[model samples]
Target: MKDHLTVVKHPLVQHKLTMMRKHDTTTGEFRRLLREISQLLAYEVTGELPMTTRRITTPMEEMDAPVLAGRKLALVSILRAGNGLLDGMLELIPSARVGFVGLYRDEETLRPVQYYFKVPTELGERLVITVDPMLATGNSSVAAIDLLKEAGARNLRFLCLLAAPEGVARMKEAHPDVPIVTAALDERLNEKGYIVPGLGDAGDRMYGTK
Candidate 1:
């Protein structure tokens, strides 16, 4: 909706995204592409991150190198699907603090309820990044963000592999300040509230389950 949602359209990300959209893409292929896409998205997500120049010792000479400045990063996974993206992101920011939240929707109520919540101690001092692979109805994402907010996380951003217009709108309406970085925004969700042409259940494909 607003400038909060940044749809990463880099060629590398787009090419890998294309592979994931193909039905014939194998599990291994899908996993690999997801990792690559995650890396590309990570670059975009870290765009605004503050960096300070520091002297580096190279064989040739000493030169100033950009190092992370400002508050450290905290990555919160919206388990268990969000774990997939966490891997690649962590490879980049290995020292970042990690957190987890578990949310499952009730079939009858179709509302999200949290089952588990754990965050770092100094959440207010860290830049929060909450990740989930799919943004279908936005119920779980919104609920997860609410949980983070309650837990005292101030600066927040969302990282997702796929998103739908409906879910995007819902999230923008709820938490416009917490920007979202995603690989692709699909057409729309179907009647069943699943992202259309979306890579099917991310959890399933990732863990080899149903």
Candidate 2:
């Protein structure tokens, strides 16, 4: 509910998400919707990136063109569903360095365990944006951000396709400095910790996997 967490309510983002939520949508359709949402979300995520002007040839005389001013950003994805969102965000900021954090919750303790992680160097200098499709329990997302924090990421943010109130609250309490941009924050988490009225399992929908 903080302004720091920008919940996008734009019509295009809302419409696309509605289509994606439909059970009749095909895997390709789901993938396309995710990509579209990611691209649109990228605009907000990268709104404050530093920019400077540079001389460029415009098929005529030289002209000044704006370009990114400082260190390239790090776009870390909480895999494997995060990769679905990653593809679209990358299209908007192709220069951003990529990273991945793999986390899966154990059914018994319901704790997140990391399976894989690899990030670019100099995280402290560049802005870091960690992304995932669903912020259900926030355990995995927080764990992944912990890793990024350990890697020297001071200025960080998160991008998710959807979120549950419990998940958002958890993230806010744990890492208040890290801002979040999401398409929608649903009602609440169901018994199994899934966002109610959510877009089901984003991993399954995006990749057509069960």
Candidate 3:
């Protein structure tokens, strides 16, 4: 992943994202697409994970097999919408440690207010990936990363399904050391801080809520 951002333009990812962005995509379908697309994005985000070879016997003979190195990496979901991405990622990395940081955007101020935070131990020794479906204003995402760092996470990456330029810039300015991976970088944000042409509120769409 680049130091700033990596947009996954894989054909399948783009296709699924389009399906997800459709206004009339059903709730169940939206969720399934998010899960599928998230796994694809996970493939990109975790591509450079530290690898070590271990001697293992195959059906034919012994061989050195490449495997992930160091402690099991942590997956920190940025609440509500983030859980949508988290579920799919867990299917791909079942052994990964999971954590959650609950934050909500203050409608008027567009600032993030944290209500809960819990993360894995030995955070500094493990790679941490924070997942959220949208990076709009980036207030909540940045606040979540701040909390993770305060908890001792060093190696960190931010993953999202869609990003607005404003949110990407915000994250780059606030956490330059952390890399960002997203399926798409949308045009811009609307006045309400929503990503323009974004697929509406992910949580609401996934849950059939307003």
Candidate 4:
């Protein structure tokens, strides 16, 4: 997508996201909605993927069929919450290579600390799409991208369920070349680094934590 940040405004995406944002929604419902929505979001995220023709034979005739070009795409989950989004995307792109980056914010420092990271080999030659549920402060997202780049991922894209303006600006400033795809761009974040009018802590809500 040409836009640095593409908000998926499809009716199904918006409707499901709104249900996910409701305070009264149960964990089971939220998880189901996330899975359903991620499939749709995956469609938007992969819109610009390159395609090529592959020779194939039909029952009646043989012809060249269009197929994705280049190496199999890579799906990098930002750990914990990202796994939720990852699962759904995997359902749609079952052949994609998978990886994970684990990060947690230090309470006092409020900065992301990487605890675990493992990415697919030859990342530079693959289209790497990193996923997370929320983009609030963007610290962890930015840090994750930094690690991915260090690991040799040149072409990368970010996908999230919700994004704050601050996070969008932060990503634009840090990785302008990497496009961001999201279901919603909510209001500003609160002092605690949570997206305002967001669905609360994504991990907590999805996993039924406090």
**Best candidate (score: lDDT):** 4
Choose 2 or 4, whichever is better by TM-score. 4
Model 1, span 84-188: residue lDDT tens? 888888888899899999998776666888889988888888889999989989999999999889888888999998999989998999998889999899999
Instruction: Pick the winner on lDDT between candidates 2 and 3.
Output: 3
Scored by Cα lDDT, where does model 1 land? 0.87
Model 2 clash tally, residue pairs:
0
Ranking according to lDDT, highest score first: 4, 3, 2, 1
Off by over 4 Å in 2: none
Select the stronger candidate by TM-score from 1 and 4: 4
lDDT of 2: 0.90
Q: Cα miss at 112, model 1 (Å)?
A: 1.3
Residue 68 accuracy (lDDT) in model 4: 95
Give me the displacement of residue 133 in model 1, in angstroms: 1.1
Per-residue lDDT over 1-210 for candidate 2, one digit per residue giving the tens place of the 0 to 100 score: 236579999999999999988889999999999999999998888888889999999878899999998799999999899999899988988888999998987767667999999999999999999999898899998899899999999989999989888889889888998998999989998888888899788998888888
* Cα lDDT of model 4 by residue, 101-178, tens digit: 999988677799999999999999999999999999899999999999999999999999999999999999999999
Give the root-mean-square deviation of each candidate in angstroms. Answer: 1.8, 1.7, 0.8, 0.8
Q: Cα lDDT of all candidates, in order?
A: 0.87, 0.90, 0.94, 0.95
Better of 1 and 3 by lDDT: 3
